[model samples]
Target: MPSEVVVEKQKLKNPPLDLRYLGDRALRQPAKRVAKVDQELRLLAKEMLQTMYTADGIGLAAPQVAVQKQVIVIDCEPDNPANPPLILVNPVIKQLSSQLCVMQEGCLSIPGVYLDVVRPQVAEISYKDENGRPRTLKANELLARCIQHEIDHLNGVLFVDRVENKIALNAELSKHGFSAKAVKPIA
Candidate 1:
């Protein structure tokens, strides 16, 4: 089947999952397989992009759609310029630098939740493109942070897990309509 057809079928058969806005358990479940880029995944990707755009987000993950798949769509295009959208399938971070950068991060799953999470300032990632071709990306700034944050969802990690200061996170969480206890770091 054509990728577009498959994505469309999936959209009809399986609706996108509503993100869980509270609780750590929902945020920790690993995503399932993305069999292929059928019509369903493609439609889901479009809807996700719409959602992200509506919410003023830079990136989104499949798990946020309530789908257990290693897929992420990103458009860090500031001012909604001429840049094309990015669709990553089964993405993996190949390299993480020791240089730490702290930036305020948020999640679609954990709605309104924002916290300063310290992570590598840059990352090298490999994944399948929209056409099922392998591709690699070296990212920085908001793009880098957004990718790392979304990829973490694919691995059952949340921004709160990487938060360096609890008090600041708690404050931010309140503003975002989230509970601070909704996330806890793995030991």
Candidate 2:
């Protein structure tokens, strides 16, 4: 079963969470595993979804809001009201596909800097739902990408760090007024 916690899929003028930007120290620290899932955590998850929607983002991580918990909210199809957003707590990557794909990726933290990143086409993940029920998800395509991207936030990685093309990465970051030095390449 999917997450039962639901929020209005609409943008709020004053979102509850204040998103931390790309170079923020909060975004650089690895998130702590959720010690316990409770009403307080669920409320934070709701605010996370609200902030993600308000920023027109498909995915969001707790660290993006300076929350040190292992939580993420994802709604790949925000336009579809029937689709409920996913709320993941203490998420862990169980597996990743060997097949890689390159797609244009953007981040709410990075704002206007959209760059190409190479990531696995499929991912198997395990997480706790808003109800604290353990769940497994095998996601592919956009959902897979979104999951991996948000999970990276848990590990203190930005999509820019996974970008292979240094030239393009530098240009994109510079154009967006972000220093290239802030990018710590994965490999």
lDDT of 1 by residue, 1-187 (tens): 2234111111223333455555746557887656686656667777776666665667788777667778898887735455667788888899988898888787766666667777898989998776676789998878889889888888888888788787877887788777777767755
Each candidate's lDDT (Cα)? 0.73, 0.93
Model 2's alpha-carbon lDDT is: 0.93
Worst 10 residues of 2 by lDDT: 1-10
Clashes of each: 13, 0
Quote each prediction's TM-score.
0.82, 0.97
Residue 79 CA displacement from its true place in model 1, Å = 2.7
Off by over 4 Å in 2: 1-4
Checking candidate 2 for backbone clashes, the offending pairs are none
How well does model 1 score by local distance difference test?
Answer: 0.73
Model 2: per-residue lDDT, tens digit, 65-166? Answer: 999889999999999999889999999999999999999999999999998888999999999999999999999999999999999999999999999999
Cα displacement (angstroms), candidate 2, residue 8, comes to 0.8
